[model samples]
Target: MIIHKSNNVTVFQSAVFQLNTTVVATEDLILVVDPGYLPYEIEQIRIYVDKIKDDRPIYLFFTHSDFDHIVGYGAFPDAKTIASEQFVTNNLKGSQLQAAINYDDEFYIVRPYQLEYPRIDFMIKEDGEQFQVGKTLFNFHYAFGHNHDGLIVTVESENLAIVGDYLSDIEFPFVYFSFEQYGRTLKTLKSIFEKNSERTLITSHGTVTSDQSQITKRISDSYEYLEFVKIQGSGEQFEQFMEEKKYIFSTIFRKRHQDNIMVYERECEHS
Candidate 1:
């Protein structure tokens, strides 16, 4: 369903994971960020973008290498693809594709387009790398933590950001990578917030927010969670920490919180 819409942007939320597919259209370019989840939902995004984008170039920007983020790749064969250099070179491409295949097989869901890993047409190599398409300026920042190749895209023209998995309201930091890396990404995000004026923040898993205080609140939540994970004692439960923060508990998110604990433990050993 359409959660939010503005002059040149429309945000589509999938029922599966509250996964968002953001579309930003202009005279020269139509950018689609991580269009995904069920096959029908992806098709709807494609149809909607196709209808509005007349002679503009379509760009499919993958924020990370996660299976869910890249699962809808084959749906838009004609769109020029975009991703971070790390994502393009990640060795886990085969497993990522298989994860998508596994999801389809488990649910007996069928899709018309072939499910394949995307071949990026444009690659973001460094932080603050800018891509210009007419009046739109896409500033790409490498955001590592949730996934090693995670990216955060900021549309300077719109003063809007498409953050891959970070700064989410629905969930806390899902650090599958490293706690330190996640913290670093949070700092980067905070810097971004400071540099920009009041901005609209679009997260993949949560509702969008334009209020600066709310954006600041999400960043504070991340920093607090990062600190919270560091206090992990021997065999301590993440659920305990979750309760202390008054964060909503769920079986699925419980597993993610546990995984955060494990990642923190591993990072602690290395440090």
Candidate 2:
């Protein structure tokens, strides 16, 4: 369903993960960011795009290469795709992505189109890469930590930042990559927020907010969680940390949080 729409931007939230599929409708193009989740959800995005896209070119942007994020690639086959250069060149790219698709297919999951990895026609290799779509200017930044190949897009004219998976109010820092890199990424996001204080920050898994306090809190909370895990380890202290943050202690998330500690330990050992 459409979660938010104003002027030329529309954000659709998938029921499965609250994954956001953002549509930026400009006079010259329609930009779709991370269209994903169940089959019907993707179809709804396609239908909406078809409704608003009037012969203009459609562009697809994947915030990262996660299975859920790229599952809908085939839905917009003709759209020009964009991503970080690292995502385009990863050695495990095809196999890992296909594995994700296979996992979904194992559940008898049906999609409107055949599952396929996105063919990235445009790559953002440098920080502050700017592109113009109609009257809007989009600045793309390479964001690491949550994932090695994540991106944070700023739509200057619309005053919106389509952050891939970082700064989520509902999720703690899920560092799939380097914890050190994640810390750097958060700092980068904080800097971006400082400059574009007026822009609404839209995270993939949480509600959109322009409130500076909420944004600042999310950044500091994530950073503090990392520090707590690093110094405290996965012991009573870590458990207490989780409790203080009101983090629900689920077996799955607990395991994920534990893994974060493990990764940090391994990195420290090697360092």
Candidate 3:
């Protein structure tokens, strides 16, 4: 599903989880971010890229080392890849690939391209790292917690931030990694949004919002959710903070909420 489209940026959402894959094109370059999910959906993205890419170089930007985010890597063999330095050196490389393979096996899905972890041609080594392609400038910031290797890419040229698997309208925090790091990540995002009020946000799941107010609200929601989780981790649950956000909370995310509590508690234990 093409959620947002223009001459510069095109956002595609997959049926699997409303997972988003964004394509950003400029005068001299075409960039693909986290191409993912089903085989046909990836083909849609691949075909579309070829259609507009012309003779300009194609670049693939993987926000992190997650299976869903990297599932479509095989389809774009000719494109150069970009990812965080941590992502390049991730210890779970095999496990990530196995998860993708497992998903395909369960669905009996066959693809023309081989399933493999993406090889990064360019790595974002530090926060505030800037890379220029043609006339477009990309700013990479560390966005950890949801995952260790996540990087928030700010396309200054497009006034867009491509955040991987964070700030979703349909879900709350899914702390698969460190809870403390996740808390810091939210603070970092809040800081980012506070400064770049004009930038549009392309979260990995759910909505692609350009509204500054909506973007600010999402950051606020995340902070509220994080504090509530912290309260729960302390064994002092006051009326359940999630009660107010029932619109975004559901059975699936509630499960993730429980997981978040456990992750937070464990972090407290070790910290």
Candidate 4:
């Protein structure tokens, strides 16, 4: 269902994981970001796009190569796909992504669409690559750490930032990649927020906020959590931190947090 809509942008939230699918409509073309999840969800996005697209080109942009984010890639065959160069390279590996899809398929007990990786038509080679679609301009920045191929996209006209899988209110830093890289990425987000104070920040899994104070608080919270993990805090400290944040405190996230601690320790030892 539609979560938020303005004059030019519309955001749809999926039932699973609260994953966001954003559509930015312009006079010349329509931009779809991270269209995803179950079959019916993708169908709903397609229907909405069809209604407003009307001969305009549709550009599909994936923030990263996560399975849930790319599950709906096949739904829009005609869309010109865009992603970071790293994301393109990761998708070319095939086996890694295929295994993830297979796992999801088995777990969900459903296969609504033929599971295939995205075919990238446009690759973002640099941090601030700009793409012009008629009067609208989209600037892409490399956002690693959460994942090697992650990206943060800024729509100039809308003053909106679409961040994938980062700055989530419900989740702490997952640190699938390098912990140091994640720290650097958060710094980059801080800089982005500082420069674009008026921009509305949108995350893949949480609420959208235009409040500068809220953005600042989220950045600080994430940085502090990273520090806590880096120092290899005690289990009691971890428990206290979890309670303070009121995180879901589930076994799954707890295990993930523990795994992050192990990875951080190993990396520290190597360094």
**Which candidate tops lDDT?**
1
The per-candidate count of clashes, in order, stands at: 0, 0, 0, 0
Collision pairs in model 2: none
Error of 3 at 83 (Å): 0.3
- lDDT per residue as tens, model 1, 1-271: 8999999899999987899999998778999999988889999999999899999999999999999999888899999999999999999989999998999899998999889999999999998899998877889998998889988999887888889999888888889887778888898888888898567899998799988898898899889888777776223466665665556746777777668888888888889
Q: By summed lDDT, which 10 consecutive residues of candidate 2 come out lowest?
A: 245-254
lDDT of each: 0.88, 0.85, 0.86, 0.86
Best by TM-score: 1
Worst 10 residues of 4 by lDDT: 91-100
What tens digits encode model 2's per-residue C-alpha lDDT throughout 1-271? 8888888988999986788899998878899999977889889999989998989999999999887788889889889999999889876678768876787868888766677777899999898899877776889987888778998999887788899988887778888888998988888889999987898888998688889899999899998989877874676766776677767635666788888888888888999
Alpha-carbon runs more than 4 Å astray in model 2 = none
Model 3 residue 218 distance off true place after TM-score fit, in angstroms:
0.5
Root-mean-square deviation (CA) per prediction:
1.8, 1.6, 2.2, 1.8
State in Å the error of residue 4, model 3.
Answer: 0.6
Candidate 3: stretches off by over 4 Å = 233-243, 246-249
